[model samples]
Target chain A: MSRKISYREAMRAAMHEALTNDPRVFLMGEDVGRYGGTYAFSKGFLDEFGPERIRDTPLSELGFVGAGIGAALGGLRPIVEVMTVNFSLLALDQIVNSAALYRHMSGGQFSVPLVIRMATGAGRQLAAQHSHSLEGWYAHIPGIKVLAPATIEDARGMLAPALADPDPVVIFEHAGLFNMEGELPDDWTVGIASAKVRRAGKDVAIITYGGSLPKTLAAAEILAADGVEAEVIDLRVLRPLDTATIAAAVAKCHRVVVVDEGWRSGSLAAEVMARIFENAFWELDAPVVRVCSEEVPIPYAKHLEDAALPQPEKIVAAVKGLFA
Target chain B: MTRKTPVNQKIEHRPPPPPAGPVPWDKDFALQLLLDMLRIRRLEEKAAELYGEGKIRGFLHLYIGEEAVAVGALHALAPEDNVVATYREHGHALVRGMPMQAIMAEMYGKQEGCARGHGGSMHLFDAATRLYGGNAIVGGGLPLATGLALAAKLQGETRLTACFFGDGAVAEGAFHESLNLAALWKLPVLFCCENNLYGMGTAIERAEAQTDLCVKAASYGMPTFAVDGMDIVDVHATMQKAVAKVRKSAGPVFVEFRTYRFRAHSMFDAELYRDKAEVAAWQKCGPLHTFTARLKAKDAKGGKAKLTEKEFLELDKRVQAEVAEAVAFAEAGSWEPVEDLLKDVHTPEGTVTAAPQASTKAGRAKSPAPRSGRRSSKPTSARGRR
Candidate 1:
C-alpha cells in the first residue's frame, strides 16, 4: 500500500511518530507550536502535546539553541527548529563550539543527541539575508552529521535515526521541497548513511542532493531526450559522504556533473568533486565539472533569484560541457 | 588612543558591599566553607608554581581572590543540581567534588583528568557532578544553564541549575537572551554573576552605561539579589535563598555576587589595569582573614572554640598536603596515545552512558597516582601577592 503525501505532511508524520513513541522527545522553536511552525509542519501539535512538550521560543536563537544542547546533555531528546539556515548563524557558536564539541571535549562523558531542522535554499525571493544555501558550511564541521533529505520517504524516515545518533545531526530541509507531492509506500524505509540513485543511466553520472536533486533529475531527463543517458545520484548524507556509492556510479558512468544550490567556491559540490578526484579519478573519461549557484547574494527579484540558484538548464549545460 | 585617561580609576568609586556578620552557619559548616576556600587558594598557588616551571601550559585563570563565590554557592545546592561555570573554573571543579588529582592531571594534559585531558583548565567537565563545562566563551554557559533548567522542569525534576560567569559576560547578548527565556518559561536557573568590577581591564562604569546590573535582570522580570562575594557567609546565604526560591516557584533568579579578582586576569595579564593601593585595600577585606577573625572573636565559650589558631593551622597543613599530592599525581599521569586522538570525537556507537570517576580512595587509584612529591611545610600567605 502506498500513501500520497506532501513532503511537509511526511515530515510532520515523522515528528508526530517520534513525539508519540518516545516520552523523551519534544519539539521547540519559534512558531512551532502556536503558529503551527513557520511551514505549518506542527499544525495541531500544540493542542495535542501541550505547551510543555510543544514549546514556542522567542527570537533568542542562540539562547534556545544552547538550551537545546543543554536539554540534550541533561537527558532529553529535543528536536529544535531554526526557521531558516540564515538565522541559524546567530546560534552557530552554540552549535559548533558547544553542541558539536561537547562529546569530544568531555572525552565521551557527554553526547548531544540533538536534531536541528532548518529551511534552506533561494526560491522564496526572500533576498540576501534569508536566501543563501549554507549547508556546505555546516557539513564542513567534523563532530556533527549533516543531512539534506530531498524526498518524502527520507523526510519521514531520517528523523528517527538522526534522533538515535549519539552526536548532533543537522537536517537542511530545502524550503522548496516542503510543498513537493510524492508517494510513500507502506514499507518505504530510509537510512542517513549513504547516497541513493533516483534515476539510472549508463552514459553520464549527475550528482546532487536536497533541492538540486529534482533539477538534476529534470536535466537528466532532458539529456535522455538527446540520447545521452544520465544517472542521478542523491547524496542523502552530506557529511561522511558515501564515497563507495559515488565511486560505483562513477565507474559505471565515466562522466560526472555535480549540482548544488550553494555558490561555487568552497561549496558541498567542491567537497564532492574533490572526493571523486581522490577516489575515482582514474575512472573519469572527462574532467569532472559542477553546476553551482552564481557567486552573489540571492536577490529579491524573481528572475535574478532564478539565475542565482541552480536550475535544470544550468545542470543540462554543465552535463553537456562534460560531454563536449 | 584618542584620550589617554585611565579606565581603572573608576575602581575608587565602588559600591558598598554586603556586610560579613559572625559565622552564621554552625561551626562545622562554617569551617567546611573555610576549608573549601583554602583548598582553592593552596591548589591554585601550586598550579601557579607549576605554570612557572613550565609543567602546565594554557591560559590559566586562577581563582585566588574569588574563592567564596563557587565555595559558598556550590554548598547551597543539592548533588543532583546542574552547574555551569566560566573558564576560570578550577575552584568550581574542586568544590563540586571533583578530585584534585583529576583536575591537576587535566591541566597537565594527561588521560586521567576529569575530561581525560580532552579539556584543559578552561574546559573542565565532570558528568558525575552534573558540571556542564568550564566554558571559555564569555556568556556562553548562561543559555546552557537555562536549558538544563528547562529539562529539569519538563522531566518533572526539582533540580535547579547554577550558572557562574564573570562580570565580563554581563554586557553580552547571551546574558540578556538567556535571562529573558528563563523568565518567560519559569525555568529553575540560578544566574550567579561574579561581578569583579573589571571585564578584562574595562571597568563596569565604562562597559555598561548603567553600572547597576540588577536592572538588566529586572528588565526580564527576574528576582535579583546582590551580595558581597568576599563574604563566604553572605554568598552561602544569598545562594541558599536564591536556590530555594527558584525551586519553589520553578522560576529563575539572578544573583550578582559583588567581588574582586586580586590576581592578574590570567597568567598572561600584566596587572597594569588597577592601582596597587586598591588591591591592598581589598586584600584587607579578604574572605579568609576577616571571616577567621570574626569567627575567633565571636566564640563566646573563649579560648578553645572550634576554629582556634591551632585548628586553622591544621586545616592549612592538610590543604597544603593535598596540593602536593595532586601535583604528584599529575606529574605521574600518562599522556593519551596519538592513535586514540579520534576516539571520543563523537561518542562510540553503542548506547554508552556517563560514568563519573569515583571520588573515593578506591576511585583515585584508577590512575597510577604517585604520592611522592615533597609537601609544602607551611601555609604561605595568599597567592598573587605582589
Candidate 2:
C-alpha cells in the first residue's frame, strides 16, 4: 500500500526507522531535540527516542560535525544535521579535512559511516547568509558521497542506504521541498547513484536535481504543451556523477538544458554540461544551455530573490534557446 | 561587552618545569617507558637524517624534546582505548603500536607505508591500534576525539579516547568548541595538550591571550591539570589518574603536558622566531637526558639497583638496530602503481559503478522491484543497479 506524505514527514519517518532499528544510530544537531529541528523535521523525536539518541547541540558546527566523524570512527552511526548549507561553512574544515579525507588518507583503515544532512537552496527570502546552494562544492570532494533526494520516496529511502554505507555521505534536502506533498510506496527502495528520468521526451533533456527538480519538471510540462517534449532527469547523486545515464539522455535527446539553483559560474550545472560535452558531444543537436541562479548573493527582497533564482519560465526559456 | 585593550607584554623564554612528583621507580615499567622514549628518539633522529639525505621528503616534525609526553601518556591508556593525534605524531604512532617499519616506509612514501604511501610524514594512520590520523589541521582532531568518546558513551562502552595536540591548537575555535562539547556531554575523553610552546613559528604567548592552556581548558568545567611534559614519570602518573577518571565515566579530563620542541616545527621551518639560546636551554633538560640522568641517579647515590648505565646502553643499542631495520624496510619498499592512484577514494561497496550505455528503446527500462522476501541486510546497495 502507498501513502501520501509530505517530504518533511517522509524524512522524519526515515530517521525514525533508522533510530528504532539501529541502536548505534543517533541524531545530533542544533535544536534537533528540544526545538524539534530548525525545520521541525525532527519534531516529537526527542520524547520518543530519548535525549541520548535525538541529541540537541549548541551552535558549534565544527565541533559537533567533527564529533560525528569521531563517533563514526568509534563504531557508531551518527547523522549530523547542520541546519542549512550556509551554516555548514562553519564546519567545512572538519567536513573537508577530516570527514572527507579520513578514509583515503587513513589508507582505508577507517571508514566514516557518518551522514550529514542540511537544508539547501534559496526560496524563502532568507537572503545571502541562509540562501545559496553549495552542494556542488561538497560534490567536488573525493572521499564523500553527495546525495540530493528530490522525491518523497527518495526522501524516505535515501537515509537508510546512506546510514548503511561505510563512508561519509552528505544528503542535501531542498529547504523549499519540505512541505511539498507526494505519495510514498510501502516498499520504496532507491539507490544513491544514477539519475532517474522523471519525464520522457525526445526533443530536449532537462537535467536537474534537489530544489530545481520541481522547477524543471514544471518547465517540462510547459515545454510539452508547446510540443517541445523535454525529458527531465533528476541527478540524485551529484558526486561520482551518473554520467552514463546522462550520456544516455543526451543520446536520446540531442539537445540539453541544465537547470540548477546554484550560481551559474562554476556550478554543478557547468560540470553536468561539461560531462555531456565530453561524453556525448557528437550526439548533440545544439550547444547545451544552462538555467542557473544569477551570480549574485541571493537578495532579501522576494522579487529580486525570485529573479536571482532559476524559475520554470527561465528553464523553459533555456530549453527553447537550446532548440533555437 | 566592552573590549579591553590588548597588553603587549614581553614573553620570557623558560626551561621546562620540573617533575611534580617522584619517579615511579619500578625497573621493568621504567625501562619499558625509557625504551619507548628511546625508540621514538632514535626513529625521529633517523628520520631527520633521512630528510637531510633527501631520502624522506615532505614536512618532518621530530618529537625530539617531547618524547616523554607520548611515551608516558600512551603507556597509561589501555590497548582498546582510541588515540587521535596531530601531524607532529610520529612518536604517538610509534607508542600506539604502529610498526616502525610501516611508519618509516610511510615517511619514504612507499606502498608498504602505514597509509600505503597515500599519506606522507604528516598523515600516519593505523586502524588496528585505533590511531585515527596524523591530523595536520591545527585543532582538527579535537572534535574527532570528542565524537569518538560520544560513540563509546552511546555504545555503553567504558573505552576512553585520548587525543594529543600542540599548544597552538588551543588558539583555534575548534579547541574551545570541542572542549565545551566534550565537557557538556560528559564524554569519556582524555585531552592531552602537548604544549610545546609554539604553533609552527608563532609562540603561544604571541598567539594566545591566556598562555596557560590548562586555564583555557578548565573554563569548560572539566578537571584540567598541568604536568612537566619532559618528565616521563609525571606524564605517566598524571595520565593514569586521568584515564581512570575517564574510564569511571566521570567525563572528560584535560592534561597540559608543558614541553618544548627541540627541532624546528617542520623541515621547512627556519625557526627565525625563537632565540637559539632558548632552544639550547630547553635541550639541556631534554626528556632523553633528564630522564636518563634521573634513572642513573641511583648508581651515583650508591642506592639499590635501578636503570643502570649498562641497561641504558643496551636499550639504546636495541633502538638503534630497530631504526636501522626500519630504514632498510623503507629502502626496499616499492612505489604504488600509478594506475591504482584513484582507488580507496571510496570503499569498494560504495563505489559508483559505470552507468549502462544509453539505449535507443522508446521507453526507459524500469528497475526490477527489490526482492521483497528478505530485507536489504547490506548497509549500502550496489550503485547503478536496481
Candidate 3:
C-alpha cells in the first residue's frame, strides 16, 4: 500500500523515528528547535526532545557542523541541519576540510558518523545568497556520501542509513520538493548504493535526480504521448554514482539526455556525460544532450526563474533534439 | 643555513633529576612529567633531522619550544576528556598517551603509524587516547571541541574537552562561533590558545586589531586567563585551575598561553618573518633551561625540588635513546596496500533505515511560524559534477 505524503512530512518522520529509537540521536541547527526548523521540518521537536536533544543554534554553520562531527566522535548520533545549501558555505571548511577528509586523512582510524541536512536548489526566487545547489561540489569529494531525495520516500528514508554510515553523509533536500506529494510504498527500502529506474523505456535514457527527477519524468510522459518512450533514471547516490545501473539504462536506450538544475558549466550533467563516454560510448546511438539551468543567478521573477531552471518542456526539447 | 640538529651532545650522560615543583605524595611522579617533555623535544628534533634528509615529507610543524605546555597541561587532564589540537601537536599526542613509536611511524607514512600512515604530519589521530586529531586547518578544531563538550555534558560523563589552537586561529570565524556557542550553552570546554604571536608569516599586532586575546574570549561571557606558556609551572597551574572551573561549572573557560616557537614555522620557512634578536630573546627563557635553573636554585636553598646538572643530562640521554628507538621503529614500519584506498571512505557498517512520513501522523508535521525575511525561491538541483 502506498500513502501520499509531503516532502517536509517525510523528513520530519525520519527525524522523529531516529530520536525515538536511539537515545544517542539528536538534532541541532539554527531555528531547528523552538523556531521549528527553517523549513518547519522539525516543528514541535523542542517540546518533544527538549533543548538538549533538539538543539537550536545561533547562525553559526561552521561551529555547529564541526560540533556535530565532535558529537559523532563522542558516541552520539547527530543530525545537523545547515538551513540551506548557500548558508552551508559558511561551514564548508568544517564539512570539506574536516568531516569529509578526516577518515581518509586519518588513515581510517577516525570516522565522522554525522548527517548534515540542508535545503538546496532555486525555484522560489530566494536570490543568489539563499538559493543555489552545490551538492555536486560535495559529491566530488571522496570521503563522504552525497544524497538527493527527489521523492517523499527518499526524504523520509535516507536519513537513517546516512546516520548509520560511519563516514559523513550530506543530504540535499531541494527547496522545491518540500511541498511535493508522492505515494511512498509500504515496504520501500532505499539503499545508499544504487540508482533507481523511475520510469522504464528503450528509446532514450533520461538521467536525472533530486529536484530535476520529477521534471524529467514529466518530460518522459510528454515524450511518450509523442510516440517516444523515454526512460528515466534517478541517480539517488551522487558520490559512488551507480555507474552500473546508469550503463544498463544507456545500453538499452542507446541515447541519453541528462537534466540538472545546476548551470551547464562543469555541472552534474557533465559528470554523467563523462561517465557515459567512458563506459557506454560505443553503445550510444546519439551524442549525450544535457538540459541544465542557464548559467545565471536564479532570477526572482517567476517567468525568468522558470526559464532559468530545467523545465519539463526543456527536458522534452533536449530529448527530442537528441533524436533529431 | 647549515645549522646543527641542536641535539646538545653535552646533555646526554647523567642520572635522573629530583622533583622540580611541589612533589606529589607519589615519588618519581614529577620525573614522569619531565620525561614526557624531554621525549617530545627529542622526537621533534629527530623529525627536523629527518626533514633535512627528505625522509619525512609535508609541513613538519615541530612542537619544540612548546613542549612544557603539553607536558604540564596533559598531566592535569583525565583520559575520558576530549582533546582537540592544532597542527603543531606532536607534543600533545605524546603527552596524551599516543605511543611515540606510532606517532613517529605516522610521520614516516608507515602502516603502523597512529593513523595507519594515511595521515602524514598534520593529521594524527588516536581513538584510544580520545585525541580527536592533529587538525592542521587553523581554528578548525574549536567547534568540534565545543560539540564534544556538549555531548559529554548531556551524557553526564563529567568529562571536559580541551581545545588547543594557535594565536593565528583567533581571526577565523570558527573561533568566534565556537566561543559564542561554548559560552551561551555553558558547555564544559577548556579553550587552550597557544599564542605564539605569529600566524606563519604575519605578526600578531599586524593580524588582529585588538592584541588582547583574553578580552575577545571574555566578550563571550567566559572566564579567561593568560599565562606564561614557557613556564611549565604557570601552564600546569593555570590549566589545573581552568579545568576545575569548567568541570565545576556548566560553561566554558579560555586560557591564553603567550609562547614562542624556537624553530621556523616549517622546514620550508625562510626565517624572513621575524628578526634574529626576537628569536634569541625568547630562547633565553626556554622552558627546559629555565626550569632546570629554577630547580638548581631551589636545591641551593635546600628545597625538596632539587636536582644536579649531571642528573638532568642523564634524563636527556634516556629521552634521546627513546627517540632513536622510535625513529628506527618508524623506519621498520610497512606501507598500507594501495588496493585499500577505497576502504573507510564511508563506514562499511550496515545502512540506517529511512525516516518515516510525518504527514500521516497528523500531529507531527505542523508548519511553524514563517521566517521574517522575504522568502526566496525553492532550491535548484545540485549542479555540476556528481
Candidate 4:
C-alpha cells in the first residue's frame, strides 16, 4: 500500500498527523498561516486546523521561537518553523542560549520538548540571504538534537519522533528536496535514531545527507556504470550521529567519499570524515576525501551556484579520487 | 518619530519616601513583607561578602538597592504561578521560595545547589517553585515568560507567569517582540521591567529615544504601569493590580519598576558609566533604611504598629544567622562527581515518550509538572521534566 508523494507532502502529512492526533501539537511561524506557509506546506491548514493551532506569527523569529520553548515547558508540544535557516539567525539566542541550554542549565528541571523546522540549502537562485546549510553549526551544540530529513519517508516520519523527543530538535528540511517525488508506504513511521544505507556496494562508500543524498545516489549509479561500485550512506540523524551504522559502512567499503553543501571550512562533511577516522580508522583502505561547497557566499547566477554546490559529477569525482 | 537622543541623560531621581505611611494590613502579613525584603537584603550582603572571600565566582550580580522590587513583585504572585527572572535574580529566587542554602550552594558551585552547580551564580533554577530560571541574557526571559503564559492559556490554566528583566533588556528585540506577541495573543504575562536606570553602563535616556518604558510597552497595545521600585508599598501595589489583570487571563501587562542598582553590574564591571555623586544620591533613599524608618515611626504619625528598634534588630539578627547557615550549607555541600558530568544533558533513556502510535493519549511521562498550583495535570508526551 505504497503511494508516490513529494517530500513536502510527507512533511505536511507528518505535521497533519501530529496536529490531528495530539491536542498539544500546534504549528507557529511566519506565513505558516494566512499565507499557507512560505513553502505552501501548510496551504489549507489554517482552515483545517484553525488559526489557533495553525498559528500565523509576525516577522519575530526570536519571539515566536522562544515562545515555542516556553510553550513546551508549559506542557504543550510546539512545532516552530523558522521560514528559512538564514532567518533562524535572528532567533539564535533563543535557540542556542535558551532552548538548547534550558535543561542543562536548569539542572535537568526542564526539557524544551520543542521542534523547530526550517528550510535549508541553496538552489532556487535565492542568493546568500535565503539560502544556507547551517545545520552543522546547530549540530555543534550539545543539548539540542539536529535532524536532516533527506528522503520522502523521513520527511513524513521524522516529525513524530522529533516531537516525541524531550529535548529541543531542529529539523533541517532541505529547500531543494520539497518537490522530490518518491514512494511513501502506508507505514511511513520510522525511528529517528539511525542512518539508512540508501544503496549498498562493497567497493567504496559515498556518505552524505539532506539535499546531497540524491546526488550521491546518482553518483553511485554513474560509478556502477564505470564498474566502480559505490555504497551510499544517508546520514539521517546529524546530531547524536548513528556512529555504529557509519562505522559498519566504513568497515564494509574500506574507502569513503563525503559530500556536503555547507562550506569546506568546518563543514558537516569534515565532521563525518573526522568521525570515520576516529571510529573506523583501521578499516580504511584509502584516505577519505570530502566534496564540500566552494568557499563563497552562494551567488545569484545559476552556473556559479551550481559550481558552489555538490553535484553528481562532484560526488563521482570525489569517489574516484578516493579510489585513486 | 525622530527625537533628540541625549548623550548623557541626567536621571532626576528624587527618591520620594512612600506617601502611604501605613499600609493597613494584618500585622503578621505586613511584618512578613518586611521580613522577605530584609532576608534578600541580608542574603545578598552575605553573597557580596562571599564573592570577596573567593567562595563564589562568575558574575555575582548583587541586588543591593533593588531589594524592594524583587520582594514586592514576587510576593504578589501565588506559588502556583510561574516566574522568569534576569541574571540579577538571587533576590527573586529567594523571595520566590528557592532555599537560600541551595542558592548559596549554587554560588559555591556545589551539587547541593538549585541547578546542581551547573548554572552557578547568575543562573539559579528551581522547578519545584516554578521559578523557570535566572536567565542571564538581557531580554531573554521575556519570550520564555510569554511562552509559559501561552502554555497556561492552551492548558486552560489560570496561573500567570511573572517575568523580571532590566532597563537594558528594553533595548533588545526580544523585549519588543515578546511584548507584541503577548499583547496580540492576550496571554497571561506579568512583565516586570526592573528599570534600574542603567543597562550596564548606558543610562536608559542615553540608550533609548523614548525614555518612558510604559509608552514603548503600551505601543504593543498592552496596559502599562509605572511604580516606585525603591518603595515596597508601591511595588506591592503595582504588582497586585497588574497580577490581578493578568491572572484573570485578561492579557499581558507591562510594568516598569523605577529603581537603581547600588553596586557595579557584575564582579567585572569597572562602573565607569555612572558618576559617584549620582550613586550616592540614589543611596540616600535606600529601600531598607527608608522602609524601616517608616515602619518604626511613632504610632500617631501613621505607623499603626510602630516596629520598635528592638523588633527590627531581632529580625535583622534572624536573617544574619540564616545567611550564616546558608554559607555553612554551601561549605558542607559536595561537588558533583565528574563521572556524572555527562548526565542530565538529555532526558535519560525511557523517560521520553517513545514514538507515539496514531491517536493514542500520549502515554504521559510520569515526570513532575513544570508548574503546579491548582492547575497541575499529567503534562504532555515530552520527556520527563524533573
User: Native contacts retained per candidate?
Assistant: 0.46, 0.49, 0.43, 0.46
TM-score of chain A of each: 0.99, 0.99, 0.98, 0.98
How many angstroms is residue B45 displaced in model 3 relative to the true structure, after the best TM-score fit? 1.2
DockQ of each: 0.28, 0.34, 0.25, 0.45
Query: If both were scored by lDDT, which would come out higher, candidate 1 or candidate 3?
Result: 1
Q: C-alpha displacement of B93 in model 4, angstroms? A: 0.7
Instruction: Give one digit per residue, the lDDT tens place, for model 4 in A192-292.
Output: 78888999899998888999999888899999999999889999999988889889999999998888889999988888989998999999989999898
Best by DockQ: 4
lDDT of 2 by residue, B301-345 (tens): 466656778888899999999999999999999999999887878
Among residues 3 or more apart in sequence or in different chains, the pairs in candidate 4 whose N, CA or C atoms overlap within 3 Å are none
Among these predictions, the greatest TM-score belongs to: 4
Better of 1 and 3 by DockQ: 1
lDDT of 2 at B37: 91
Q: lDDT by residue for model 2 over A1-324, one digit each (tens)?
A: 677889998788778767765667789999999999988989999998899989999999999999999888877778999999999999999999998998778777777888999999999999999996999999999999999999988887888788877788999999999999997665555777678999999999989999999988998899888999988999999987999999999999999889888888899999999999899999999998988899899999999999999999998888888756
Q: In angstroms, how far off is B137's CA in candidate 4?
A: 0.7
lDDT of 4 at A68: 95
lDDT at residue B33 of model 1 (Cα atoms): 87
Error of 3 at B107 (Å): 0.9
Give the better candidate number (2 or 3) by TM-score. Answer: 2
